[model samples]
Target: MTTTYDPTHPRYDNEGDMRDELLRVYDLCHGCRLCFNLCPSFPSLFEAIDAHDGDVEALSVAEQDKVVDECYQCKLCYVKCPYVPPHEWELDFPRLMLRNTAVRRKHDGLRAKLTDQALGRTDLVGTLSTMVAPLANAVTQTPGSLPRRVMEKVTGIAAERMLPPYARQRFSTWFKKRVTPTLTRRQGSVTVFPTCLVEYQNP
Candidate 1:
């Protein structure tokens, strides 16, 4: 198995190679278990391996995907790992999982495909949602509501999870109207870049 995180690598998203790499890394992680305290992904992985009598290969694709699903790309494992780039083991669990996601999403259903596409267009979604901020905020105020539950089914984002609320007015709009015009004396000019993360969720 080629231990690689580079997407440009020829075998980066090759399913066959990815499977082999998963097994290799899973076996290493299973033995080290140093990241046991980090996140849900480690616990899930350990439990799955233990259930299969310490055989990493015994984990089915679905089981492996479950472990990946539990990972929220926190990358805490990379910091805790002793076998990252500088070491010969060259393990990068987070990047491997990202590759897994990229490859797997291609085979996802139409709803999931559409949802993924929509999500990638964060600027568009953020703009639209912020345009109707009052109604959007009200509808998504709480988790486990009918709307939230329906959203979970449609987008695969957990209904029990809540993102930071969108600002009634996006930062870009506010900056242009409030700050940009008021900047009579400018020591240094600044550029404000906005994405969904900032424009909606955490603005």
Candidate 2:
């Protein structure tokens, strides 16, 4: 659909420079749809784009809200977008969306504070996981346990999911002892990320 922007928009004033840059970046989007297809966010984003193409102001408050809510913030699109590569670095879509998301939060208010809280605090999760581990294990093993239902309700993680048991010792502590300095020359140094499975489940 053909799109047209209004000469006057509520947020348009004093945003000429930003608007120009956004248009320039929009032109760089080749419509290859590679990132679109990869992202779970595309369904909402595609709708917004289609709406705006017909009329810049056609997007209602609800439509814009839904569009921003769908972004998982995983940055998969940033990594997958073909335009992000090359010497030119024509990639601006992710940044643009981020900026738009900020505008959304400011204007529409926060939507996923609980999810953010849960994802951001690793220490809290680790502490809670260890504290209730025995009960957690039993509930998972037991039939029709309340804890099993509660877990699914709060996080939407399936009750039937096979979660690894917590380790008796933390992996970091074990690694400190096991990791020894190699004095031999011509040998390469190894880097390890110590994934969740290896670090927490099987120290």
Candidate 3:
């Protein structure tokens, strides 16, 4: 009965469990349709469900993947949903999309693209890749290299695609260890709320 989006969950990588969770949430989405216009995934999901005469369980693996692939985690649907969390449905669209990618990476392995795996675990990948930044950078930046060629075959990402390099240290880590800049004049402090995209695009 649990619909966990946490990768740490025991069932997180189970294909059958993932499918059940998808059906549960997709059914909720189908019944409501409040956020259909929020993204391309919803319209495609609704269309497929309707084609099956409103039976969400009738959706094939390919059809389910169609919706999962369309979601880019903008999270507008989660904000717009009335059945989120405390409502007992525990509906979390963005996290569910994340779970789908994580499950695919673990279960599908070679078939699961590197871009999808890297995008989902920005923090983990950034930290680990930063430890070997030069080598990682070289492989990802140089498309025709032997490492990249092997990478493409193993992870299904094209050798020609350039992955952004990981920074030497996480921005937060750098900011904390940085020497405090003295202000010569009175200045107002501001906070930045950058999207997840900024995690990999560090300075």
Per-prediction tally of clashes:
0, 0, 0
- Estimate, for each residue in 1-203, the C-alpha lDDT of model 3 and write its tens digit: 45887778887778887789899999999999999899899999999999999999999999998899999789999899999988898999888888877777666654465656755686687778877888788778897788988887776778888777767666666666889789999899878664444544464
| lDDT (Cα atoms) of all candidates against the true structure | 0.84, 0.55, 0.82
In terms of lDDT, model 3 sits at 0.82
Query: Once superposed on the true structure, which residue ranges of model 2 sit more than 4 Å away at CA?
Result: 1-91, 99-112, 139-144, 156-162, 179-187
Residue 53 of model 1 has an lDDT of 99
lDDT (Cα, 0-100) at 95 in candidate 1: 93
What value of lDDT does candidate 1 attain over all alpha carbons? 0.84
Model 1 misplaced stretches (Cα beyond 4 Å)? 119-123, 134-203
* Best-to-worst lDDT order: 1, 3, 2
Worst lDDT 10-window in candidate 2: 1-10
Tell me the TM-score of each prediction against the true structure.
Answer: 0.67, 0.48, 0.59
Best by TM-score: 1
Off by over 4 Å in 3: 114-203
